[model samples]
Target: MKIPYRGVNAINSREIDKVLILSGTFGEGHQQVANAIHEATQLSLPDVESVVFDFMALGYSYLYPLSQYVYMKGIKKFPRLYGYFFQKTRKVNSFSIKLNAVLSPGMGRTLKLIQEVQPSVVVSTFPFAAGVMSKLKQYGLINIPTVTIITDYTDHSYWIHPLTDQYIVGSNMVRQALNHQGIDDSKISDTGIPIRPKFFQAHDKIELINKFGLDPDLPTILVMGGGYGIIRDGLTTFRALNALPQSIQLIIVCGHNEKLRHQVTEEFKHSKHRIYLTGYIDYIHELMAISDIMITKPGGITTSEAMAMELPMLLYNPLPGQEQDNAQFLVHAGVAMLAENLTDLKTKLLHLLFDPKLLKKMKENTRLFSKKRSTFDALDVIVQMKRQVSIPNFSVTG
Candidate 1:
């Protein structure tokens, strides 16, 4: 008698197992990074089955409205309250253990995904997911290598849990910051974060422009409000871009901001040059493929993607938290430039566009900062680590 053959993942003995990826929607960076790693790992390690998870979508999905009310109201609207909680938590004795105790109940449903996946290696791009996995370990549910990727350049108190196995950080500075939080150097690697595979491929700009129906010769500037459409002074920025020479085309991506999207379209309907307006688009890789410059709010994932595209950044009105730090790093590293206010932003943009030498240098610097094989390197590490795991002599489960 012959048994049925498994499709792709079949093994004879304890083969390295699957990867369970936990992510969240607090920001696009978390989910984007998680999915990129998952995709990369899936391709690089064929034996490894990777499942991407949205932790907040578990029980919090039921209480999503209330959860959003608290998160948005606490962090975005009235951040002082959130800061108070953050500060108080930082001072707590054994904050990780205490936090695990308090949040474990709510995180029970998240562990259910892990139970279902039964992964040998679990990776999380969201900070809170690390806490949830840590809690699950205490409940004797997880025993695999649990890794966390810090999506931001700066480390936060929320990412300081001691139970986390390894950290794929964006910079050496972030690794040092983790050390300050008592995390060992052995647990951290400066991976510069992860971006989707599409960003790494080179495309002919002229061809891309022609394909998008944009003028091949025009100098293009891409403006983005992140993946959530919060471009604080974005309207004014586009208005300024509209005043530029007809040789310049401004591309505005108002992610999920329908009102802003419609408003920008109406404002630029009869424009002399061209304005590429979009709402919650997934083709940012293509947009970055053709643009000469980017005007954005300095989110880490966006910056990394821009770096991958070799696009120079012109940061505008970054937020007060990690975004501000990200802007500083970009400016300091020579990968991008910054503008203190709207007037300065307009002037800088015009100056940068007119100066070809400066633009070329910025692009070169960004390409250098962006790791050429970032996704592959991250995947290589996961595969090598999994091979070292001593599981019951078993094989991949189809």
Candidate 2:
């Protein structure tokens, strides 16, 4: 009835009917990955019922909202301070260890949830969830084969744990980074970060253009600033784009930011260049399909979705920590370019808009680099791991 801590316990594949996905809403990427995994499981393994639990909400009920607020404000107002702490905690240090220990008050609730759910396998999309699960395994309270899907392009010490059976990473670079941290090559799989299946589907560009009332003749620039519409100096960026000599249309999606939407609409109402501004909508994939270039921050999920659609990116003013790292990888990979300031952003956008050849090359690179079926690939790995629990001690590594 119970599984051992260090060895594989024989579990019937048919009994793995439930999957518990632990996620956090600190940022959109973690929750998005969790949703992708849940959708993938439903589609590929119809027999399996997948459930996602918000780790922060369940564990830190009273403080979750305040913590999220602090995180957003910290990153937006003092990115350098946040970046300093992020980099400082990149590797295991005394501070991080103590911090994890301090966070142990929530582990009891997490364990209670696991016992109630009685899941056959556990998957973690949040680093803190992974830590809690590892601690549970360490204490012999649970023996589920835990998988940690790292959503970012880089690896951090916070995601590492002795009891995590497998790690699904976004790229080989992250895998190598983990390997350098003493993680065995066998325990890591370089399955690109999981994305929603809808992102992988093809859309008719002409149909989308007509449906959205976009100009099919002029190049369309799709601008986004994550779910909260936190584009830095958004009005200035709009002004710069409007001043460009090239005649182009703009589609700006100010997600859930009513003030931003109103401000942009009022500011650009009488502009000569055609501009369309809207609030949050679910049809981002279609918008991406009809656009030539995307001007946005380099959040992992958004960047991955754009790559899947073969849309070249113009990364503008990325946040200092993971966003910066994501932008660097994308630029070096030739799938994207970065603009650190307003002047640089304007110059880069104009150049990229004029250079069709460069745009085509970037699109080609994105096509080559994208793993559209990453969600399914990750699902397959989880399924295979569930089936391989035939011996007392089995490794979930390839």
The TM-scores of all predictions, comma-separated, are 0.87, 0.92
Give lDDT tens digits, candidate 2, residues 32-125.
Answer: 8888888888778878877788888877889989988888777878888878877888888898778766654577787767666666778999
Return the top candidate by TM-score.
2
Question: Model 2 compared with the native: what TM-score?
Answer: 0.92
| Candidate 2 error regions (>4 Å) | 1-16, 103-105, 388-398
- Give candidate 1 regions above 4 Å deviation: 1-16, 69-105, 245-247, 387-389, 392-398
Writing each residue's lDDT as its tens digit, candidate 1 over 95-117 gives 74576455433465665555555
Considering every candidate listed, which one attains the maximal lDDT?
2
Q: For candidate 1, which ten residues in a row score worst on lDDT?
A: 1-10
- Candidate 1 lDDT at 171 equals 79
Supply candidate 1's per-residue lDDT for 77.
60
lDDT of 1 at 333: 78
Clashes in predicted model 2: 2
